[model samples]
Every structure is written in structure tokens, then in C-alpha cells.
Target: MTTVKVKLTHKNYDVKIEKGLHQAIGEQVRSVWQPRKVVLITDSNVGPLYLSSAQGQLEKAGFEVLPVEVPAGEASKSLTKVGEIISQMAQAGFTRQDGVISLGGGMVGDLSGVVASLYMRGIAFIQIATSLTAQVDSSVGGKTAVNLGETKNIAGTFYQPDLVLVDSDYLDTLTDRDLVEGYGEVAKTSALEGQDFFNFTGKIRSVQDIRDHAPELSERSIAYKAKVVMGDEKEAGQRQFLNFGHTFGHAIELLSHGSLRHGEAVAIGMVTVTRVFEAEGISPEGLTQALIDRLQAVGLPISSDLVGTPLFFQHMINDKKNRGGVINMVALAQVGQPIIVPKPLDEIRSMI
Candidate 1:
């Protein structure tokens, strides 16, 4: 078991990473939260697989578990779904002291976090991350949000979880593509952390290989992200490095009309941004190709056909990271070194 502590000004929580911890979640929750009406939110794909074990454990531990399942995909991260979850919690008489449990991947964690944040002003929440993307990225950070229209995570908050339970066993049910989708995040984190992580992931070629090394890979990734979150809880400074591939990634997500997965979009985003930076002579030469080789080795896209299109242009302009008519894209100084470069919209567009 690897326990990483995330210390913020408002609260501090532990990210518990252990294989097969899913069956013991009830006892774990009991340790941190008192018995209460705990609402567990999951998605279609995950609910049938592990929901019963998680819910049964919580119920056995005396928590009033209210299990809810959303459609499986990025579409569920919206105000409409959040309203439905809130309505259910309200009807069940949940209150400020009640807790929420996110029992699936990134969308589940993000939506559940926001619901917990808004319900009765605020409520305690726990993350039982079932996907690599959630365990390593979304679940650790205090960033909880619901996408609004074409904007991803446009409506959200920096609300920390009371506990994060990451059990790598959940990866067993994932399809090959699902595992590959997560490697994009693994790639991003490795790039920002250092060359050691970069090389570790570079050698992994298959999604099954990624799953084979889940526990250690997840523990390492979570710790790096936790360290960043601890230092910049609100994304005011150092935390932005965590968005290494996100600037253009979010735009790619919007332009895909929900076809591309988040991590996959970020994979191409990392490549796109690296290529742009290398062309501008800001990044060291071969940085783009080096990054591309690893991403492609894991079956992630290294470029997009929409890069110079009009829709891509519009979404990049509307990116959430933009401020005062300038956009900030995280560029790689090398495999493990990241730098944030702020540029005008036109300058960014010309690179694409």
C-alpha cells in the first residue's frame, strides 16, 4: 500500500493506492468519515462490474449508500446530469454532513466532486478511482467540474476529497483502448516529472503491458501529481504545469464533438504543442519527435487533421487557459522539463 498525503490550506487528504482495495473500501471510508447518507455516483460501463461490491461494503459498514449511474462517456459531465444527481440527493434528505462517493473514472470523479461541492453548499466526498486517468490525474487534484456546452470543465471548483482510494484491480475490466486512453495521461505526467518516468513509459508498447504494471505506475504517477497539487492547490502557478498537454487538448476535445477521449486528445495536444514549440525554436530540437515516438509506441495519436482548421481556430481562442487575449501553452524544455509559454492568439494560430 502506498499512501500519499495531499496538504492544502483548507484540508488535507490521503491518496491510498493499493491493488484489490476495492473490497475493503467500507472499512477505509469508516476510518475517515462517520456513518452518513453516502451517495455513490458511477457510470454505465462501470456500475455493473464493481458497483455491488463497493455499495455492499459501504452498506455493510452502515453508510446509507445511494447508488446512481450515469451514461458512460464525456457527455455525462454536464449541468443536466449534476441537477439529476442533486435532485436524488435532496429527495434522500442528504445534508452538509453527508458524503459522496465517486466510484468510477474521470467523468464520475469530476461530476461527483462538483455535486458534493454544490449540494448543501458543501459535503464530504471520497474517490474510489476505477480508471488510470482518474487515479493518476483527475482524482488527485481538487479540480472538480462539469462541462458546459463546448467547454470542458467550464463549471467546476477546487474542492478536495476527504479520501482517494485507488485500486488498480479495476483495470482488469478495461478494454485495450480504454487502457491506451489512460497512457496519454501517464505520458503527460511522466513528461512533467522527469526523464526517469519518461523512460519507464517509453518502453511500454501495449495496453496490456500498461495494465501489467498498473500498481507501481499508478503509485508513481499519483505521487508526482499529489506533490504538484500540494504546492499549487488552486492552479495559481506550479499547478499549471500539470496541464502540460491540456491547452490545445481541450480544444481538440471540443472540435471532436465528443468523439475523442480526454487522454487521447491530450496525447495529440502534447505532440501538437511540442511540434509548434520546436518549429519556433523555443523547445530543444528533436523534442517533438522524442515525445511522438513514445506516444505512438503506446498507440496514441501524434497529430491531428484539424490542427489548422477553422473550428480548431475558434476553440483555441475560447480555451479556458487564455487570459487577456494571450494563450499559455505548456511546452517541454526536454523529456522531463516543462515550461509555460504565453503568446498572442495569432501567434499560437500561426504555429498550428
Candidate 2:
């Protein structure tokens, strides 16, 4: 078991990475935020597998657990779904004194966190990430959002969780494709962080390796994220490093008509960023090749199907990170060092 404490200005939380830690939820919640009621928000796919265990634990802690299961996939992150879940909480007599527990993957965490943030202004929430992507990245961050049409995360808020509980055992039930999708983010982090983290992930060749290793890889990735986030909690400075591959990734996801998974699009986005870096004479030694190789090794796409530079540039302009009509892209100066370049629309169009 490994623990990383994330200290926010208002409150501090712990990200507990361990195997079979799901069973300790009752005690952990009691020790941290003691609430009379807990609304466990999960997706349809994950509800059947682990919902009972979480509910039982909360029940044992004398909590009135209201299990709300939404349909799985990205589509669930919508205003309609969020409203439905809030209504469920209302019918269950939920109040600010109560807390919400997200027990699936990124979709659950993001959607549930939004509910926790908006319901009665704000309330406590816990993250029980069941997927590699959520455990490593999305679940730890305070950013929670839902999509609005073609734009990604257009409706959202910064709502931090009270606790982040990562259980590696859930990876056992993940499909190979989902596991591969997760590696895209892990590889992107490697590109931004350094080769040592890349080397650490190289040992993870298969889903079994991820599960068998338990909290080691998960804890390390979370720690890397925490370090970056602590320095720039609002993404005002060095924290933008986390978006190394996300600019192009988010566009690809929008352009693909939701055909590509977030991680898969990010994999393609990382490749595009590398190409742009090379064209700009800013390519790092062996970095581009290594990233390409690692992405391929993880079954992620190295290139995108969309080829029109004009359309791509248009999407980049609408990016949330854009400031004063200039897109701020996070590019690699070297492994472990990221440079934020304020790119003009014309320059960005030419690069695409």
C-alpha cells in the first residue's frame, strides 16, 4: 500500500493506492469525513461488479447509502444525467452534511464530482477509481466536467474530492482495449515527466502486469500529478505541463465524432505534438521515437485519420486553455521539462 497526501488551500486529502482497499472503505470514511448519508454514483457496467461491496462497506459504517447507477460511457456526462442524479439525491433526502462517492472510472468521477460541487452549492465527495485512467490522472485532479455538444468539458467546475481510494484489483475485469486506452495517458505522462517513469511503465507489458504490480505504478503516477498540481493548482503556471498531449487530443476526440476514446485521441495528439515540435526544430533526442514506440506497444494509434489542417486549427482555437485568442500549447523542451508556447492562429494552422 502507498499513500500520497494532496494538500489543497482549503483542505488536504489522501490518495490511497492499494490492492483490496475497497474493503476498508467503511473505516476510512469514518476516519475522514463522517456523514450520515452517502450517494454512490457508478456506471451501469461497473455497478454489477463492485457496487455491492462499496454499499456494504458504507452500510457497515452506519451510512444510508443511495446507490445511483447511470449508463456507462462518455454519453452519460451530460446535463440531463447530472440532473437525474441530483433528483435522486433530493428524493433520498440528501443534504450538504452528506457526501457523494464515485465508484467507477473517469465518467463516474467527473459526473459525480460535478453533482457534488453543484448540489446545495457544494458537498463532500470521494473518488473510488476503478480504471487505470481514472486512478492515474482524472480521479486525482480537482477538475470535474461534462461535455457540451462538440466541445469537450464545456460545462464543469473545480471540485476537489475529500478522498481518493484506488483499488488495483478492479483492473482484473477491464477489457484489453480499455487497458490499452489507459496506457496512452500513462505514456503521455512519461513523455512529460522523464524516462525513469517511462522505464517504470515499460515493465508493465500487459494487463496482468498492471494488476500484479498493484499500487506501485498507480501510486507513482498519482504522485507525479500531485507534484505538478500543487505548484499550479489553478493551472496558472507550471501545472499546464499536465496538458502536454491534451490540446490535439481533445480536438481529435471532437472530430472523431466520439469514435475515439479519450486516451486513444490523446495518443494521436501526442504524436501530432511531436511532429509539430520536430518541424519547429524543438524535438528532443529520442523522445519522439520513444513515445511513438511506447504508444504502439500499448495498442494506441500513432496518427489520426483526419488530415485537413484548416479544420484542425479551427478546433484548436476553441480550446479552453486558449487565452486572448492565442492557444497556449504545452510542448516538451525535454523529458521532465515542459514549455508553454503561445501560438498564433496562423502559426498553429501552418503547423497542422
What is the alpha-carbon lDDT of model 1 when measured against the actual structure? 0.87
Which digits, one per residue and each the tens of the lDDT, describe model 1 over residues 216-269?
A: 788889889988888888888988898888888888878888678888899998
Query: Candidate 2 regions off by >4 Å?
Result: 206-208, 307-311
Compare the candidates by TM-score and give the number of the best one: 1
Model 2 Cα lDDT, one tens digit per residue, 1-352: 6889999787789998888887898988887876589899999989999999889988988899999999998889998899998999999898989999999998899999999999999989999999888988999879999987667798999888989999888888998778778778887787677778888766666656656664676777889899887777887888888888889898887788768888999998888887788668787766777778777765788888663456676787778888777888888878777788888766777787
lDDT of each: 0.87, 0.84
What TM-score should be assigned to candidate 1? 0.98
Lowest summed-lDDT stretch of 10 residues in model 1? 311-320
For every model in order, what is the number of clashing pairs? 0, 0
| TM-score to true structure, per model | 0.98, 0.95
